[model samples]
Target: MKSLSILITTVTFYLISSMYSYAQQTTDQIKDQQFTEAKETIIQDEREALKVEVEEINNRLQNGSISKTEADTLKNKAAEKHAKNIENRLIILKNTLELADRNGDQEKESKTGIYVGWDEDANDFVIKTSVKRKKEKKEVYDFRTKTGVYLTWGLLDLVDDDNSYGNTDVSVGRSTSFEVGISQTTRVFKKSNFLRIKYGLGFEWNKLTPRDNTYLVDNNGINTMEQFPSELRKSEVRFTNIVIPVYFELGPSKKIESQNYIRFSTQKQFKIGFGGYGGLNIETMQKLKYREDGRKVKQKIKRDYNTTDFVYGVGAYVGYGSFSLFAKYELSPLFENQPIDKNLLSLGFRLDFD
Candidate 1:
């Protein structure tokens, strides 16, 4: 009976010791898990706060609200703070692991060295967090819109004239027109960047050199074409106009792989434009250079030779690259009810410099 009692006591003691050890291990594991969770929460919060601050700084730099030097300084400061936070987290982890080893928690110690839930691999026992900046909302119209001065040269023609002269009666070289203008262009929509609105102010000067030595004479209120007795080298009737023009422009923009700003490029792209212009007759004059009695004589005369006061025209342009073919047909007659009815037409090239 004494031997059996001794045996029973030994078994009971061993079982109680085993139970007590298991209970102690379970409590330690719970404490370790809670500590890990608390540390993770702290690290996550710090990382998120740092990310927000970095993003704000980058956005300001992208929009020209902050200078490069300031941005670099601010970003460096943020990086330092982030690095410090990570260093602190790593230190906490190291202490936790040491404490787990001291407490004989082998499982927690092994897991800490095995894996770290982060954006990158943590085999080196360091945690790195990154701040991803959102793409900026840039004002596209300022770059897309073009403004510049353009030069125009066109062939001037008279249609439905009551004069004795035919279509070929005007000198092609001397019957020339010139235009100088400044234009502003803008994209209509953000998505539809190809469509644009262009408008501007300009001047138009038309010179008509008759084929024959004919001078314009105002008979009462009529402009009569007459011949000069002297041989003439040049006789040109000029009309100067101040006009406002508007057009709908369509083209592929100069594509650039850029993130910040854009500029006008010399890239070739297909483009088309159609528009109209209206203007007032600002001046009218006739210049004549002729030889009279073997001496060169020059004369300029201002006349009310019955030219129309208001003028308007419809025009279209098509081209590849910076050069374009252009044509303009006058909607209003050049001269009112006279012995001959006439309208002006122009054909040439349109060059855009932005």
Candidate 2:
């Protein structure tokens, strides 16, 4: 009986020793797995740091603050270091995880599973990530309206025959005029440079001089005859007229580049239009010099002596940038009872606006 008890005690001690050794082995395996996981985390953090450094270098290059040589050197170093670190970390992680798996330790396997769960959670975090910001769009305008004023100088040409006034030997001289005007423009058709409308008001001055000794014969049924010299007839004749003009203009569409309170430059560079004009003579004054006035004395004539007539013309405009120029010819006689209808021609420059 004493021998059996001693044997039983020895057996119990050996079993306890074996159980403690197994427990210690499990703890060590768990510790090693945790250490490996920590090393992997440090490797991943170093890679992210390298990526940040590379991005910083690229940003510096874009900002023109870094030299090309320095940027290239830094980029190469970062790439090489990142590659080497990744290769080394991958080898270490593979070998360590393989050894932990071969060991068949439950604690190490559990730790590795937990780390995989953490990795899955990180992947989910990345998948759920988003950026929040307000998006904006650019604004644009289609059509624009503009206004302007201009000064013009031109010649007045009359197409009507002066001989109808019964002065066969009379000659009509060129009638020159000065004009000042204001204009307005509106965009009409937009695409294909199709159309626009321009309207304007202007004042005109005309001067006319007769070139012959015309005669007017008066005969009575009682055989009485009378002859009047051209100078005498003209002495009673007046020659100046003022006009007010209004016109409707149309042309190709254009874009405006620069503008002031009163002027603008446009992209629509060419224009063609036709309009009518009429004016009231606020003041028409004329002076007559005759042979009887061989002493060169001048006589003042009234506005009513010569008839005030309407003036009109057709014209075209062409230009680019801030400057625009136009040329037009008058379509009607500037004076009434004249031997010839002298037409007017004009050239003008205008400043445009919107």
Candidate 3:
């Protein structure tokens, strides 16, 4: 188990790093273009202002409030003023660009608490306000809850009881589990976001395929496996549960602090969570496929197989970004009355889109 966990950790981190590196380097090559576009905008705006100033000077000359010489002087002064304004503003803009991070994360929280960052995905400027100012007072908002949807799927099998000598009756390779749900993460500390309470509601599906052409048989009240009479193409038992999995997630996040708001982001970072899940077994079903009298036949069996109704398990995960290596083990017995007790065990992957 330790070796397997280490392998999963290494592989998951490697994959996440590769993906993030590729994405971070894939720029639109639009930063330089933004400079040109901004320069053009400045020139156009100054020219328009210059034109208006010149018209006003002409109007003054027509009214005889100023002579041609005076009007020309005024127009020249206005033109020169606008030219200097353009030069100065352009310099400021250039300096701002220089201050930006070279890696294209040019998002800034300006000194004046105002920001206009380029949104590459939106192809527009994303303007943000820091705090609301009223007279001499400012109101700042700090929110602590973040929510996201998670999807998980992985290997599933049953762990034989320590007291029992029976072997596993299901094929580990053929068994699988899947879960999908919404999660809400809240900072556990007032000043630090390193520790968080992550909880969610998920719908889980666990399927186990019996080994050696065996099918689940309810011998009176006890659920047992029996060899299929015909050539068994497939034999599987599936359980669906509505579970609530809660985990205490610990991770470091980069702080995106502004004058008005502060946020901690764990995107593309390392995190580990240890928690458990408890829920009710909503449904149980079995599927069978075989050939009978030269005809293919399929059967869907739904009956009480003495399966546990309430299910609970402990789980842990460690990963970077959205992907994680997830492992879980159930404490409750799978069947109520059985010769050998079997506990459900699973090792899989989880993706939390938080």
- Count of residue pairs whose backbone atoms collide, per candidate: 2, 21, 0
Ranking 1 against 2 by TM-score, winner:
1
lDDT accuracy of residue 179 in candidate 3? 96
Tens digits of per-residue lDDT for model 2, 1-354: 252234334433443343343334434544555544544464556556666776788789879999878987886676557555655554444445445556443333223232211144332111112233334444334444566765554433333344332232333333345566676665564333345566666665655433444322212212111233434434222233344444444444444433322222355455554455555556656555555546545567554433435545676656553355666666664445554444445555544443
Candidate 3: which stretches are off by over 4 Å?
Answer: 1-141, 162-167
- The whole-model lDDT of each prediction reads 0.69, 0.48, 0.77
Model 2 Cα RMSD, Å? 23.7
Candidate 1 lDDT (Cα, whole model)?
0.69
TM-score for each predicted model, relative to the true structure: 0.57, 0.39, 0.61
Clash pairs, model 3 backbone: none
Give per-residue CA lDDT, model 3, range 253-273, as digits (tens).
887777767788888889999
Query: By descending TM-score, how would the candidates be arranged?
Result: 3, 1, 2
Deviation (Å) of 219 in candidate 1: 2.0
